[model samples]
Target: MNNEITDSGVATGLAKILADVAGRLAAAPLSARDPLHVPAVATADARVRGMVLRGVDTTRWTLRFHTDSRAPKARIIETQSAVGVLFYDREARVQIRCQGTGAVVRDGAEVDAAWEAATAFARRCYLGLAPGAVTGRPSSGLPDWVEGVRPTEEQLLPARRNFAILSVTVDEIDWFTLAHTGHRRAVFRRDDGWRGEWIAP
Candidate 1:
């Protein structure tokens, strides 16, 4: 982790750091290779899973993730709400920890748009068994016929029912970076209007 830290002049301002985070997240959804594209999302019950970063709503201070409505975490999030998302970019040696409340939107404008935006192959996951089902054997959970194949619109009809969006309204963010000279950390809260404050790392 320390090896990635370079002597490049680090921005010591809270606003700059916040802007950097926003920019990285804004680009995450467009590129699968982005380090922040798949972040570890944890529910209130301590279950954590890597979820694809679907969209970011900066105005609403929300992060959107696509998930199956039948997934265990989806049900947990609907009831518990409290959740955490961790993002780390090794090359930048930065870590962003976000705490928020989540909501599972099964049938809404956002869900419909996300579903429509996904490719036929990408949407195939929802056509499988619910995540975490006991298959009693190693499995991708996807049906055998759809393996390595994209389903047609008619074949994908049922998948829309299982598809849902996990939207998290971020309340707080803790950003940390490791450096050779010294480490930097900052905390930002929505209640404070995102006027971030630096903290000792």
Candidate 2:
């Protein structure tokens, strides 16, 4: 019995070390030119098709992504705030899945601040037609307003109606690590105030 307990302790310690390494790898920045530097939002469609929507991480716990106000996912979010965000590092073979509730920021300084940080290219996604509008075949291409015009900061200021900010509050995180010895899984559940513990990896 004593030997079994010792073996379990050692395994748990190794799992903790592996989990730490994996977490750091997933949080590390992507390549200088990699567009995925920002966090990606995972949304589930009717057929369970998982779509990753990329967005910038405002801070460690907060992420900001802009979607057309008319997008179907926006409405889905409004009705159902629960979501899952997956962050993984292939080299490290570590993946972190966060399940949480999301809320849309509508007014006040937070919305204004998010708007200020948005790039012209990002803001361009909301211009012209509404989200999910039908597109008919054109002889040439999309109109000049859609294809040619890029909105300046001034042009985007009043267009806030089409912009939205989603805030996800993480409640649980599942950490998985792949190592030569074996696979390790740890589930971290939030406790009162601030505390966490590793259970059965």
Candidate 3:
């Protein structure tokens, strides 16, 4: 009997598991970068008190998200740059957790590039009055400044003042999968490389 688990077998198994988890995450329509994209995001607002944002796997694993400058979450990032993002897919029975430190980037070529990529509707997210302001029941739609009409280039300039981009540099990722017969877990940490271990289901 071949007691040794071939590296190919291990790789294949991990690939299949990752693909299944990715499918589940895609089906859930959760933003890989924004935990708020998940339905349960609001429920944990009090405890977590921040948005679950993901980063792109680029040179620095740049994690970008838009928020109003006045939102409390911005302050949270300022005080505490370290944060975690959690992703769970019920159908696939998988969870992905990412940890990293965040920073706000404003007024630069990068900011301009990100802003250019945003759609007009997304830009509208920043047009409202100071974020987190309490408001009574609206008798009508949002104000003209924010919704009554499209913003011009000049208007967008000031709007950029309120827009903020958050970048997260990933330090580690923990991936887990649950199955009827068994469970799988892997932790990938920067600088330390990768480690895999199996646990009882």
Could you tell me every candidate's TM-score relative to the true structure? 0.89, 0.69, 0.70
Which stretches of model 3 miss by more than 4 angstroms? 1-55, 139-142, 192-201
Worst 10 residues of 1 by lDDT: 1-10
Worst 10 residues of 3 by lDDT: 38-47
Indicate the worst ten consecutive residues by lDDT in candidate 2: 1-10
* Winner by lDDT: 1
Alpha-carbon deviation at 200 in model 1, angstroms: 1.7
What is the number of backbone collisions in each predicted candidate, taken in the order shown? Answer: 0, 0, 4
- In model 1, what lDDT does residue 178 have? 97
Q: C-alpha displacement of 104 in model 3, angstroms?
A: 1.4
Clashes (candidate 1): 0
lDDT of each: 0.86, 0.56, 0.57
Over 68-181, each residue of candidate 1 has an lDDT whose tens digit, in order, gives: 899899889878999999999999999999999999999978788989999998889889999889999999899999999989999999999999998999888899999999
- For model 1, the stretches where C-alpha displacement exceeds 4 angstroms are 1-12
